[model samples]
Structures are given as C-alpha cells and as structure tokens.
Target: MILGHTIKDYKRENLLHDVITGIIIMAVSIPISMGYSQIAGLPAVYGLYGSVFPIILFALFSTSPQFIFGVDAAPAALVGSALLGMNIQSGSKEALAVVPVITFFVALWLLAFYLMHAGKLVNYISAPVMGGFITGICSTIILMQVPKLMGGTAGTGELLELLEHIEKTAEQINLPSLILGILSLVVLLAAKKIMPKFPMAVVMMAAGAVLTQVLPMKEWGIKTLDAVAPGLPKWSFPNLMLIPMDEVVTISLSVAVVIMAETLLAENNFAQKNGYRINDNQELLAFAVGNLVAALTGCCPINGSVSRTAMGEQYQGKTQLMSIVAGLSMILLLLFGTGFIGYLPVPVLTAIVISALLGATEFELAVKLWKVSRTECFIFWGAFIGVLLLGTINGVLIGIILSFAEMVIRSSKPASCFLGIQPGHKHFRDLAESRQIHEIEGVLIYRFSSNLFFANAGVLQQDIEQELERRGNIKAVILDASGIGSMDITAADRIEILYKSLKEQGIRFYITEHIADLNEQMRKLGIGYLIEEGCVRRTIYIALKDMGIKRPYPLEGGVDNEERSASRKRVDNRMQEFVWAFGSDTEDQIERQIAQQIKQLKQNGDVEKLLHGSWSHMEAFDEDEWLEHLEEHLKEIVNISGKDERTLAARFEEHRREIHERIMKEHPELAQRFKERRHRLDEHLKERRPEVYDLVVSLRELEKRKDME
Candidate 1:
C-alpha cells in the first residue's frame, strides 16, 4: 500500500478540512450511488455498499492524491447490458446473484492487466474513440432512465429495446410523476449552472423524501424506492460458476478496459494539473484491489468517479485521507441514515442520474471534431451509433477499427514540400510558405516529412516525378532527408528505382542532411553504391559542392516554366517573385505611393530625392534588390495607367538618367549594379515577347531620331 507514503507530509491542521470535504462528497454521492447501483442491476443500497470498502481500499493502494472510486455510470451500464443479454432481470434475485460474479471477473481482469503492465495500451485509444464510447454509454443509460419519469420501471438494453419500452410506457403516463420529474430536472440543471460546486442532489433527494412522506405520492402514481437495509454488508466470495466463463470474460474485460482508459485519462489530467505523477501500473493494482473488495462485499464493479473527485478537489481535500473519510462517512450513513431513501421519489432520482450523465457526455468534443476534421467526427458518430444500434463492445470495436484505419491513411500520405532558399537564412525552407523564397536554377530539393515506409513510398515517387516533369531541365535532384528518421525495404527499393530512372533521363540524384544511420540503413538495404558514388551527403552544402553548385546558388529556375539561358532565367525568376507578392493588382495597392513618388520627382526635379518603398510596394531591407524588381514591373505600371509606349519609354529614360547621375556622383560604388539593372528587364521581356519589345525600343529610337533632326 502507498498509504503511508501518500500521507508522509500530512499536517495536523488538515484533518478538519478533509473531514468536511469527505462529508460533502458523501452528501453528493448518496443519490448518485443509488442511481448507478440501479444501473448495475442491483437495488439502490448496493451503490453505497460499493462505495465504502472499495473506496477505502483504493485509497490505501492508490498513488493519486485526490481520485475517487465508486459505482460510476460506464461500468454500471455495461454490467446492466450484460444482465439483459443473459436474460436476467434487473433488481431481481437472479441479477443480484449474477452481478457479483461479474465484479469478480472485472477484478481478475484488472489483476492480469496490472501483471502484464498493460496500462500503456491506454495511450493507443485516441480521444475521439474514448469520448464517443463513453458518451454512447451515457446516452444509452439516459434512455434507460427516461421511462422512470413516465411512471414506468427503468428499461435496460440497446436503443431499439429502450425505444420500444418508451412506446409501451406511453400508455402509463402519470401526470404528477412527469410534472415532478420535469421540475426536478429543471432544478438540477439550473443548480449545475448557478452553483455547480454545491451538493444540490442531496437537497433534492431530501425534498423528494419529505414530499413522499407528507403527500400521498403513492396514490398519485409516483413510485418510491424500497427502504435500504442498513449496517455493514457481509463479506463473501462471488459464485462465478453460476455464469458461462466466456460471457463473463467478455463482459469483465470490456468493463476493465473502459475503466482503465476513461478513469486513467481523467486521473492523469488531475495529477498533471496538480503537479504530481501517478504510477499507471500501480493504479491498475489499486483498481484490482478495490474491485476485489467490491465483489466480496456483494456489490457491482467500481470505477474512478470524475464528479466525486471534482467535489473533493473543490472542497480542498488533501491526500488519500479524503477518500478514507468519504468512505467512513458512507459507512455512517449506512448505519443510521437509510430511513429517508424509502420515501425518495423515483422520478427525482431518475432526474439526478440523467443530469449527471448529461454532464458527462462529450457533446463539446463532437462539435470540435466537426469543425476540425469531418473524418474524425465520423469516427465519433460511428462509435455513438454503434453503441445505440449494436452494443457497447461492438461500438468500441468499430471506433478502434476506424481510428486505426484513419491513422494508416494519414501515414500513407505524409506531408512533403519543395524546399527553397530565403536568402537571409543559410538553411532552406518550404517554398509554399513565402513568395520571397526561391528554388535553385537546375536543382530540385524535395523534403519528405516522415519516415520512408511502404505506405508512403509511392507518394514520394509521385511527388518527385511530378516536380521533375514540371521543371524541365533539372540537372540534379536533392532529397532533403532531415525529416526522415528511417527507411524500409519498399522505400529503399523505390529510391533505387527513382535513381536509375533519373539517371536514364540524364539527371543526377542525391540525398542530403540525414544522420549517418540513414546511410547505414541504405547500405544494409543494398543501396551502398549511393554512398560510394558521392550521391549521399551529410548536409545540403556538401551536396551542392559535389554538384559544382556554389553559395548564392542560382535561385533562378526556368525548370517550372521552360528551358532558358542563365540571364533569362535569372531575370524571369526576379519578375516571377515580384508578381507573386504584388501581382497585377499592384497598380491599385500602391497607386497613391507611385503617384506621390512621381510627383515628388517632377517637383524636386531629382529621382534620387524620391521616397523609398513607394514603387517597391513591399517591406524591404535591400533598396537595390527591390529597385531591380521595380524596373521589371515598370511595363505593367505604365500599361495599367493607360500611357502610350512612347510616354513609358520617356519615363524609363528619365529614371535611367536619374540613376546614372546619382550612381556616378554620390554612390560611385553601386555604378556597376545600377548599370546591370539598366537593361536586364528589357532583355527578359524582349526574349519572352519579341514584338512588344521591338515596339518599345522603336519608340525610344524615334525620340533619338527626333533629337538628331
């Protein structure tokens, strides 16, 4: 037991607060425990019986500071469903006889779980599957309880049976019971919103008990609970030989798995929030011990209670002593205060159970998944509908299968992107993220952001082939293997095939920026020639050096466009980058700025004094870089303003004259850069479209001829 270790730092002054918190938890648990007991196919009092010894035992063994174990809804509903499948009646002699055996098996399964250290398996059950499975169980239980409000017994089993029960019970509608039930639900839901921390269920149960005694509710068709027989329950072993071993095993394993997944998730969350760690395997042992005691005491299965734990935490309950006090408090209630339970109205209790289950349902998670991924939302709905139409076990199986299938699909086509240089940063980045980033002139750098396995090998081949086809004259292809942690036979075979295919097409293939383990894996997979032939490199810089490509590596490629010379490719890339950022609508976006800069130039009679960034139309750290981009877009700006080519040529001449005078007089160092920018744009346009280039040039020639005349 971890009890001594848990209370090692126990303060003498903390006793009173733990006692008070325990009392409040007992107050809240009375109606809830009774409701879940009914759900477990036992009479209302067994819920209290389940709460006491089991909780005290769990507190003794648990590492958690504030997790509560009791007869909770999920396991109770599962047991109740088991009863229906076996044709056992609810709250009857046969059900009471068979249920303890189920609890015995649940404990046995939990022991096996602890022994095998199977708690780690909970990590594999995704959130949508757990949320949907639990919500489905709660919804099923809600439908079971709905008949109580209409003056009928709580119906059990799947959706069709419950719907049929409601239809059959429609003839037995008691006006007083229905009205009381609706009013009780109103108060319960209202209290949940208004004072969520208060124990409103105890107050409502007290009111129902008083009303049943004072008014002739029995005469009015309002059912009341049978009075609980008090004092501690006698301890005895469950006669598991009564039920078939296979049936019991199936039901018990399902219940144990549900308890571990749902309860551990919630408990671990509380532990993390409170800055503590829980031992998963030890927690499994605690559950086994708690449930073993529950079975010996003739109670149904027990589980971690989120509601009770929240109340304990809210009341500032510290250490496992809080669970001890809560258990002891329930023991007192069983000894002295079982009288009022007989007068408690059935609909009122039904309302309390329904209210709690409603709160427990993960409706918000469904909404969130809907907005995030419809496929995941489908999984949520699949589990929910499977529970309602099929059963809990099948519902959970369907959810797990769907989750696994989705995971496989995601792995089959992982994220891959083309890498490019951003100039200021030495390393490359994804080109799709920014317009400023550019690819190398004759190299394709593709990054696959996951391990290369059979499922995604085909995706890698397809992405590379498509890029190569779009980029015509690629001399080399570089695979950025930084994201790849490992490779499989299928992926290695595919890589070898791709290397041979590209070699046939006269393109060299290289893999770079990967750990040495990758090369070792490649060698083991029979592709060691890549390492020997200098095709596998430790970094992109080394790969470029091997390819005779150097730094400021040509970020100008006609590969995605068409084959072109170096100068044409460079000028074309510059224009393409500019148009990508500030496109055809650049005239509208920076219209005022351009006009102001032009007016400032005409007013001052000097282009050097013009405001910067007015024509660049983007945030710029390099004035020369953006100015070169502007020279390419002068044709578009002139055409958009409805100016003739003659007028545009004259405007271009004025800017050229300003640049020459400014570069020669003040910035003599930049004379060569300014001279390079002078005709590079015209050269790109003339090569791309000869007629328009000739028309613009002829207008300049006519001006020169007139000056000669």
Candidate 2:
C-alpha cells in the first residue's frame, strides 16, 4: 500500500512538471502566433484564437502531445489570398467569419487522408522538389513584403506583375519605411545567426512598437496594426450558404490536403527526433475539430505550426500541458496585452515574416539540389514560376503533376545490359567490361536492372527486340532476373506478349534467379510455370541443349562416370557409416582430418604425379590456395582410405564448405571472409558441374556461322 502510494505520487509529480513546461511553451507561442496572424492579414485577436481552443482540442486528440498546433504562416498566407478572392479584408467580419469554415474543410480533408492511412503518399513529394518549392515561396514572400516594408504604393497585382511595378517605383520608396524594413531584415537575420534560441520576431516587434511611439509613422504614411479588440473567446461562423459554396468546397479541399500533409510531416519529424510516436489519424481528427472551432469564430485556416512546435521542444515541453498552458497564457494576454500590440509597425511584422520565411527556406538543400537532380530542380523552378504568375494553389498542383510525369519518363527508358564473368574472376560483371569472355553462340543473357512494371514495360519489350535484331542466330534469350525487383499487371501482360512473339520467331525465352517476391507475383498471375527458374547459364544451357543446341564444354576424355565399371569406380566403403558427414565438434577437428588426408596423398607421391601430369590438379591450378596449402601441410587420410583424386577433390570442396559453416556457426567473430568464402564455395559446387556433352564444339560452329555473316 505504501509503495503504491509512492508510485502514484511520482506520477503526479511528473504530470506537474509537464504542466509547468507546457506553460512556458504557451508563453512563447502566444507572441509568435500573433505575429504570424498579421502575416495572414488577419487581426491580432485571430492569433489568440489560433492558440486557444483549437490548441486545446488538438491536445485532446493529437498524436504528438508536444506538437503545439496553432495558426502558422503558410496557412495564414493561403487563407488571406483566399479571402481577397472573396472581396474580404483581414479585419472585416466577413473574412473573419469564413476563416474557421476554410479551416474546418481543410481539417475534414486531412481526416479523410488519415483514415485511409495515406502516410506513404507523402513520398510522392520528394525532398528536392519540396526544397525548390520552399525556396520559391520564400522568394515570393520576401518580394511581396518589400514594397510594404518600404512604405511605398506597389500597385496590387499578381506577384510577378506587382514585382515589376515595385521595380519601377523604387525611386519613390519612403526612406523611413525602407530604413525600418532594412533594419528589420538585418536584425532578424542577425538574430538567427547569433542567437537562434532568442525570439527575433518578438524582439523586432517590440523594437517597431517602441519606434512608433516616438516617430510620427502616420506622417510618413507608414501602416501599423492601429487597433485591437480585447476579449475572452467568442463564438462565430462563416455564412457557408451565402458564400460561393462550390469554389469554397474545392479550394478548401485542396488547402486541407496540403495542410494535413505538411502538419503530419512536421509532427512525425519532430516526434522521431524527440523519441515519440505520431498518430496521423488522431492528428487529423484533432485538427478537424479545431478547424470547426476556428470557423465558428473569426480565424483563418490553421495547421500545426513547425516554429511553435520547435519552441515547445526547445523548452523541454512534454504532453498536452504545454499547449494547454499556452492557451491559458493567451487568455491572460487577451485580458491585458491587446492595446500594446496595436502600436506594432507593419515593417516589423514584415521583418518577422521575412525571418520566418528565411528560416523555413532550405538554402543548403537548394544548392545541393542543382548538383543532385536537374530534373527535379526544373520542376521546382517551373512550379515557382507558375505560382508567382498564377497563384500558390496552382503552382503546387503543377509541381505535383510534373513530379508524376517525371516518374513516367524514367520508366519509359529502363537500363538493360548483357553480363558475363571475367576470366579468372568469380564476380559476374557486365559483358561490356569483361570483353575477354567469348560469347556463347545462339544464346544471349540479358539483365533488366529495374522492376517489370507498367512504366518500363514497353522499354523492356524494345530492349528484347533490339537483342534479337543484333543476334539473328539467337535461339535462346535468358532474362537475368537477379535485378528485377517487382512486376505489375501491365508488365505481366507485356511479358506474355513478348513470350508469344519470341515463340513465333523460333526463339525460346527463359527467366533465371528471380527473387522470391517476384516469383510469387508471377505465380499469382498464373505465369510462374511458363518460365524456367535457375541460374542464367544453367537455364540457357539446359534449354539450348534440349533444343538441339550444342554444349559449350562437354566431358572430353575419360570413361564417363555413368559408363564406368563398378570395380573401376572407387568403393563407397564408408557409405554405411555416412563418411560424408564431418564432425561438428569444432572447425579445428574437421580441418585436422582434411589436413591428414592431404598429407598422406602428398607423402604417397599422388600430389607429385598430379602436379606433373594434370594442369587442373596442380597446386597452382587450385582456385582456393588455402585448400592446396592445407593439403601440403597434412599427413594422410587415416579414417577414410583409398579415396581417388576425383573423390578427394570432391571431398576437399566439401571440407571447405564444412569448415566455412563451422566458422560461421561457432566462430562468428573471426572475419567477414569466412562468410564470403563459405557462400562462394557453396555457389561454385552448386553451379559448376561437368556437363555430359561438349559445348566447345558447338561454340566453334556458332563462330563459323557468325564469320559467314
């Protein structure tokens, strides 16, 4: 009972600490949220609304307890533009009323995605593409705000057209506003560089507010917040029936998807860095509910703000305490701090926005992107131009569409190659690199280094056709399936078409070494049995041999094992005791047995006879020098007797495999080479076996045929 009480007290104490941390995060969030609201062209009160009930609601249901969900710059700018289209301004009741409605619809869209578990869909927007889009957006924001910061009448138009007008009126720019703007930019940039932890936005806002008290900003025609309404949270709603429901519905859906995607990404990223988990579905619901609240009052589209979340994390905030505390802090500010904010200058707000934009911009990635992928860089620039000319929503749409188009383009041209192993090298390399290996006649081994999917299906077909065209005598085409990772229905259809087309051309098609996943996919599509499964050489060799194609390397001179007399053949004397089975006690024990056998063979002069007579049996001829070295060091095969050279060679290979397996099984820490040698020897023994027919003679015939051409 005492222990239980102590545990309960500990939990309570931790909860209190979490609550305290939440309060500090909220304290920091309020000022930033207000500043961001100005960026959205909304009243300062809207910022409070953003950090209040919506935050609390998100805290209740959001996956990330630490993620401070509130009004952010991106959504605010988007909402402000949307309101302008509806002939509404920031402080107007009409714009304020619609803010929550837009937010609600956006939340609904996010909820749909979460329910569908569309987290993986975020992969479509590659990092390079996002980097470009962010840079473009930042550039646009800076340019758009420059005229306002200079206190100049930059005629309202599209972003690019407005920029052109601003350029023309540079001489008429107000000196005081320009100075203020420049100072703000410098301070914001400096703050980020020198004291990243300090709230530069707030500091700049304070400076601008103080400057307004002494300077006659209105005399200079400088704009300011001017007025603020102080009150507790209130209920409100946008007139959905009166507004253009169709436009609202469509635009709201698009905005919602973007907000959800960005928010979920931000939440997941922060959660991972901080060692927590994010539930996409719960976040969707939370934001959806919050947006409903925003729409009821006078708030614009709101999403999880990355800046505020970062602040919360920096302050070591955990759980919903931070968001709740931040909300309460906002309530206190609303009751006391409304009048002071009205003195804040537009130039300072511009500085804050600019700083936020600069922070959001991925300058490093922008530089790397140019060198990394020109195609993706092009899409980002293209989208930037589109958005600067058309609008934000259109620009993002074009960027996404272009991204999809790029995928199609890459799939249209897959990489194809002919492969072979270099002479005296075990690695299978491209035939282009290892030109010394003679091409087996009437056979071509092609490897498709991509998935057999719809995008590259036609490309695969064209490559196959090209191979056939190049080699008219090609009777067999073996697909090296080692690289093919996947296949789709369209790819399957194309393969079926190719199979029939080749069959008509008197050529047999085969697939070799396909991975299990692809093999299963083929089986599921009912075409597994159509293609033979094995190594490219084995499959092609067997197929050609069956089709009357001559073997490249047939057994030449000794009596065939199949035809040899039983008396002439060495006895399997230890067959009853299963002599092939080596002891599992240790690697040293099995190695000692093999060494003894090799020594006996050497002392008996069997090694000397083989060295003098057979090139293949010589010590230098052995591909694995370790085996030959061990043979020289050993005394005799005492346990198993009378093993001929053929049997001994086979046993030696087996011994190597056994020793490798023992090292891997028992001495796992020895070296990486133990695993490599084990695998190599296993593959060699499994793949390289003597064929009954001569293949060299067939190659000679094929060479003559090619020479005739």
lDDT of each: 0.77, 0.60
Q: Give lDDT tens digits, candidate 2, residues 1-709.
A: 1223323454554465455555545544554566557656677667877778888777767767677788765677677777778777766766666666776677667667667877666556655455555555556656665676777532333576767867865867777777887888898788767876555555666677788899898898777764557887678555666556787778788678767766765566556556776656667777777777776666767777765665454434556666766777777767887777578777767666556656655567646667887787777676667656765556666777888888778766777787543333333356786446434456677778777788888887888798779767777777877768888988888888888798898887877645545655775676654622211122333334445543222221221212233233222111111111112222343344445545556567454332222111111112243453343322243223455534445445555445546545544454365545545644543343322012222433565797799
Q: Give the TM-score of candidate 2.
A: 0.63
Weakest lDDT window of 10 consecutive positions for candidate 2: 572-581
Global CA lDDT computed for model 1: 0.77
User: Each candidate: how many clashes?
Assistant: 1, 21
Off by over 4 Å in 1: 1-44, 63-67, 72-99, 238-251, 261-279, 305-322, 516-529, 557-709
* Candidate 1: clashing pairs of residues: 471-559
TM-score of each: 0.70, 0.63
